[model samples]
Target: MVVKKNPGKTFEDNLQESIKQSNEKIFFSRIKDTYIPPDLRQKVRVTKNDYDCMMFARSHLFTLELKSTKEDRFSFDESIIKQHQIDKLLEATTYENVISGFIMNFREPTNKVFFVPIKEFIDYQYIAKNQIKDHKYKAKINKSSIPIAICEEIGIEIKGFKKKVNWHYHISDFITEAINTYRSKV
Candidate 1:
């Protein structure tokens, strides 16, 4: 089935449409923040939830944080994915049948997408950090950023077709990979 990309649609919008076309049983929604008026100020407190969207398919719930960057690498130091977001994702993974992760879109020069499970992401962070600390390391590693090569190694590359309007990503592939990974862990 062809999932057409609309001209002004956001990444989440396209993803929702793709999920809809992928499976009849799957449901997707973009989480929106409750608007708080400026007048409330100190009277009302709102905690930010950085999750971009959620999906329910085949009795499994998925919380996804979406990020699109034109750059070749996503920088940890630059806070492309915030600390709170990381905490939320990690927390979600502690539960059963709850798959939480990130969908990173590398745009422009490389129109590629990847679904990185939280555990793998954390492990990669540890490796990156250790590589930074090791002065005798031979391979050139960027201490602050996760380059595309590393993303390909640690994450599942989402396949897609580029149409004249936009890209039609196979989101089902991501769902399958996530479920498989989760099952393997369990």
Candidate 2:
């Protein structure tokens, strides 16, 4: 019998390779440290979408959506923010037991990270009720099961001369950082 390839695993490998190539830090130690039983690693699945790096491990999982733009005005797409995770769960037939996952978007040239809970932040529509500065907003996670559009590049902005002073994101330093961050969190 021919074996089927796992897209999630492929995407995760690509992400790791990209990070490694850049000499930056991307953590995979969480795979080993999972409280889930050893049998579950087999349960874990990885994949990709139009522009996402997906991973699954039991009731919770994550996706690192990759993106790049010409200038500074970049943002995350409001729709299908969790589609990768949702689809993964659907394929595994265990999504009913899972709560939610996270969506981390990386806008290129600006190694800044915007992390949001798939079910909480991504799915919600916030309506601003106030005028000018006092506008109040209410938001909710979209329960409609729509396609996950995780990243968006709205536009860009002009940086000041001081931008030269910002510390560059060295990949090796970032890799160490991702690992250390995960270590402390666990």
Candidate 3:
């Protein structure tokens, strides 16, 4: 019997590959140490619209939407941000005790990271849109642009002038940082 290939299968595969490549033990370890929740199986699931990954560790829940590019930077066109993407991110925010975020992993010119809190990220998108309307914004709305803006605005992890980041280390680092930062907020 022949089997059909899922159109989204490639995207899902890439997402899982990135996660699998990253130091998952450290990711879970950090989450485990930082938050005191019941023991539960770690689950990462992909859905059509809601989130790229719905990660559950015991009772700790995290909604992660991932975007990747071979470019060296994060900034992209606002058109790339789909309505459903924003809608699902917004939905994650309403849930209590859930951490929702957008993760950008750039694979060119060396891997770079941007793990942004979803609520604040959406808020900044509006702010960025307004800023563009008010003035002639020269920047493209890409992966890194608004996220970097919000990181600076909110005093999160700063990916400064440093151009190169080791992907293996950085992915784990980003996950560790995201878990810790959001865990503190709630």
Report the lDDT tens digits of candidate 1 across residue range 53-158.
8888877888889888778778886356788888888888788888888888888685888888877777677767777465432334676777777778767898
True-structure RMSD, every candidate: 5.4, 13.1, 11.1
lDDT over C-alpha atoms for residue 134 of model 3: 49
TM per candidate: 0.80, 0.30, 0.55
lDDT of candidate model 2 versus the reference: 0.33
Model 2 segments beyond 4 Å from truth? 1-14, 18-53, 56-60, 63-109, 128-186
Q: Write the per-residue lDDT of candidate 3 for residues 83-171, one digit (tens) a residue.
A: 67667777876776677777665544644446667776765666565554543224444433554334444423423233242122334
lDDT of 2 by residue, 1-186 (tens): 998644334333444554444532233322321245677767876443433444333222334343333233223344433445444433432333222233232334553333333333332323111122332223221233211232221111111111342222233443333333332322
Task: TM-score for candidate 2, please give it.
Answer: 0.30
Order of all candidates by lDDT, from best down to worst?
1, 3, 2
Q: After superposition, how far is residue 26 of candidate 3 from its true place, in Å?
A: 9.9
**Candidate 1 overall Cα lDDT vs. reference?**
0.76
Native RMSD of candidate 1 (Å): 5.4
Q: Candidate 3, TM-score vs. the true structure?
A: 0.55
Which ranges of candidate 3 are over 4 A from the true structure?
1-48, 72-79, 132-176, 184-186
Which 10 residues in a row give candidate 1 its minimum summed lDDT? 132-141
